[model samples]
Target: MPDSLLVVDDEPAIRHAIVRAFAELTVIEADTAEAGLAAVRERYPDLVLVDNRLPDGEGIELIARIRAIDPDLPVVLLTGHGSTDLAVDALKHGAVDYIEKPFKIERLRTTVSHLLDKQKLGRQVARLSGKASGRSHLVAQAPAMKRVLGLIRRVAAVPSTTVLIQGESGSGKELVAKAIHERSARAEQPFIAINCAALSEHLLEAELFGYEKGAFTGADSKGKAGLFEAANGGTMFLDEVGEMPLHLQTKLLRVLQERRFRRVGGLTDIEVDVRVVAATNRDLRAEVVAGRFRQDLYFRLRVVPVPVPPLRERPEDILAIADHLLKRLAPELGRPGLAFSDAARQAMVAYAWPGNVRELANAVERAVIGAEGDAIRPDDLVLDEILLEQRPAPAQVSAAVQAPIAASSAPASAPALPPGTLLIPPGERHLARIEAMVIKAALADAGGQKSKAADLLGINRTTLYNKLKDIGLEQAESAAG
Candidate 1:
């Protein structure tokens, strides 16, 4: 579907000009704030361009209202040359950008294109992260993790049951929480997450339930909606739930029991339909016994307890998970096709991984960026004895397991590798070139088979095709040449 642009301006000339300039886009125009809001509710456009001087009210005010409806929506303000201050204020009020009245058509088009591209990328990233949080992406080759996955699947179908996930830090608790949320009936709704340990008690309360206008110092003038409100009709993941202050825990228990909560300083009770998924590294049972946590709240949260096993207990999954993460991380780090040597893989598998999967990902990312060639050596990893003990004997990393690692076995279109080599010339390591190279190699390896190539590269066939289309490799000749 073509993207739509909403132009909210009282000036006919400005609106007509915008409509004429973007003949490719579907332009919907409104001359007043009320009309613009109605258009927004009726047709959710990809972007909004609102003049600061709307017929009924200020564009900045409309921007706030638009944000209240959908915080992710992009709004741009149109301002007079003398109203630069108002433009800045509009940005502070959640307008993504502003344009002076006498703006160039090309500049406006460029700005709109840039913002649309940004929104597209944001959506793609969100989709990718959602996929990453699935059960399959959790890397459960080991029995312990397999059992954890089983438990998660069983409980995920229960929509309203509050889940308390206990695990060591970096043990993929959030991933499990997200998997449950995704599987539940509320899958289409929001999945808001916050760390209880990251904020002060007062701040956390406001964040959870929100506050009224001027309810506290430094608060937004327009009373903000809290995560609970934001997550209405969805799921909320409370990470480090054991760190919640006792006073807030009491309020949380009330919400669990009543399914309603009042804003921090507001009189009205706000109702929300949201599933609560709480996770913590600490033992809440122990915390309750020690008088640091409320027993009643603990029971409320642990309606179904899910335990995420640490990496040490799931040693068999270390290498496989590392390989999975490497494929995902390589493109993001702008070093496509980077892979760990057999020695480094052995070292990774042998390590205790005290910090769990999070640490492993960081180490892999560091190694990928630091590697001189496509093959990442132990030296490139810079892993000290503190992170890894005695390295296990070297084992061959399978070409099937890591397609980019075994470039020599790749197709004829792939650039010639000297021994174990695959890279662009020095100082020319651009993402596009590396991406094109990897795609060509994968396609070559699969004998021009897109689906098989996608499998080889650890990505979906559609994604592979999209990447090829994006990098001007859609045609066989481009891919081969």
Candidate 2:
């Protein structure tokens, strides 16, 4: 469909002329502010044109009314030859641009074209702002992320589809939920998230289904409303639902079936109009098989599942995410801003990243703290030992696993070595290599018997085998024989 326009002119001839000029435009005509306001309520136009002097209202007045419905809608004001002052006033009041009655066809066309482009950008900003606070406007261009954005758009239109966001931890499920809520019917309402695994059953129950005063000892004298009640007419995101206890799961399932709950010690049942969007890393279906979760509850929450992929699955997003994080962290860190070095960027894309986004964030935090220059480097990422363990070894590293003391395969460009000499590069020596050498030397002395070799190496047999594997020196089968 072509772009739609609402023309608010007192003269029918003027509206007809505009409609004729932009034949492809869908025009909605209104002669007065009342009619224009009604038109806006009935249909949202992509662009609006208003006469500076309407019979019942000023064009700026209609612009103000339109602003109430959609504050950022682009408006163009029409003015007479002597109404330049009124045109300026209209522009100030949020009309994007103004044109006099005698405006050239070209001038009007150009103005309208520019206004439409501006509106397209506005729509994009509006779309992105639905995600993370402040920076949800940072939209991605990657194909996978583009697909993710499309899913967010389609799913957000539905009011209460419990989105089951599955992803490696730290892949920004919470941000996705926030974006959905921001773009939905309840955009202006509250959005609350409770981490199901973060608290005990009694506390989780008390917090989720609020306890009335004296529901339990040490309770505050005044009772509290639960998150659902507090987030009434909005959204309540139950994060990490896989961690919720069995007893609380039943209450949660009941509330999902009927949006009503009883406070822990209160007689009155409270009803709420809250939409639930839950997220988790655990496979609830598997949990069901394990008898730790309710299948019915799983069905309810998975009404519209949104699985955010792991960072490793979308390594292409690492640079963008890193760029965004750096921009955000710079001012917060009170330091000179930084970005990732090419090597660092390569490292990020190559790493298996088992920790996902949280770990990526921590990695960036380390860079921000340790970096002495303008960009983050591989050296700056203080990865957890576990994550390091999961990463792939260098090509030469695999060779280290095969034989304990092979010729040191140093690159061949160095100065000539002395006859029968071994020269190990600086920083190239490692304990594995040393242990491999010792084991080889000892085995040679012991005539290849592991028991004798172990004694000769001064270590137990199992420890010798472990060292053999560690240093790429597991004995050859024939040699072991």
Candidate 3:
């Protein structure tokens, strides 16, 4: 969609001029301060051009009010009575730029375009860093995760279904919700999300279902559209839904059941086609039993229930997720070509990640910064010592397992050792030392062919190369070849 620009000036000529200049944008006009504020709420413009003086109030004050609604919305002040003090005050009041009367249209266009581009860039950065929307691909290799993906595909086929996602914190509930939306028929529409516990009761009401003009104290005089209206024909993800107030829960239930809602303090009901995806770390069944949550709402939201397995339960995915995280974090942190030591990989697999994927991401970021060499060691991971100590010891290998280790020392021309063979010396519990010995044996068995050695070790060539570098066998491999 083309960006929208709001022109708030009493003079018809000035507004018309700007609209003509920016013919590409959807220009909205407001003749007075009151009308301008209302247009801001309803139209959701990308940029604003307000005359210094309005019929009802000063443009300087309106800038502050517009900022209260959206701190990031770019506002440019146009003044016929140009003064240095007026320009400084306008900026202090939150106007991004102040232009004197009879300004060049090209200059105005340039400023507006720059601000919009900057905002777009900022949003893109936030999305890539996983701070804004959950639109990225999910890394799910474990069988439990595959089951969750299966559920998502089934639910996505029914775009209007209300979904309730239950999972521990940081288990990627929002990501799953986004996946459903992206795969659904309404993928082209907006996918908006809000944390139910972040706002107060009244604010949350106004935010979800927009209020009409003069609805309540401190309310936008020109009533605003709520997230439900903005997210029409798409998905609305309500995070921490279990913490929503009871009164709001009743209203939400109505919206879910009827697909219609009246703005807070508004008489007219607005119908929407938004799919609501509600998620919570808390068990809503318990909350319903305790009378803290509405049973009817709980039933309404759970039309499709998706349970995301925690990181600890999906042990098979730990290393895969870590590698995924590293691929993103490596160059970002200026630590490219980094690899985890065998000990660090073992420790990460053994550690029960209480905080789940979010915690693991943080640990990887920290390790990237803390690692002194190309290899990330156990200390670089900085896992909980107490938890590591409490973990079970490695199981003893049988004679059959020992046979492969013994055969791995054979000459290059000898029969290839069985796939997935690793030589762990008797009574050897040191993970790094055992890993080194296994890599050496694999190299010996393959006659220093890294590719064949990687196949025998059941890993990719890049991973085998990293292992070789970590174990200081790179020089030996070069010499043997």
TM-scores of the models, in the given order?
A: 0.55, 0.56, 0.56
Residue range 337-385, candidate 3, lDDT tens digits: 8998877877787776888898898999889989999999989988887
In Å, residue 106's CA in model 2 sits off its true spot by 29
The number of the candidate with the highest lDDT is 3
lDDT, candidates in the order shown: 0.79, 0.73, 0.82
lDDT of 1 by residue, 177-280 (tens): 87776556665578899999999999999999999998989988998899999999889999999999989998899899999999988999999999999999
Q: In model 2, which regions exceed 4 Å deviation?
A: 1-141, 384-481
Query: Where is the poorest 10-residue window by lDDT in model 2?
Result: 397-406
Instruction: Show pairs that collide, candidate 1.
Output: none
- Stretches of candidate 1 off by over 4 Å are 1-136, 390-481
Q: Give the clashing residue pairs of candidate 2, or none.
A: 130-179, 131-179, 400-472, 401-472, 402-472, 403-472, 404-473
Regarding lDDT, does 1 or 3 come out ahead? Answer: 3
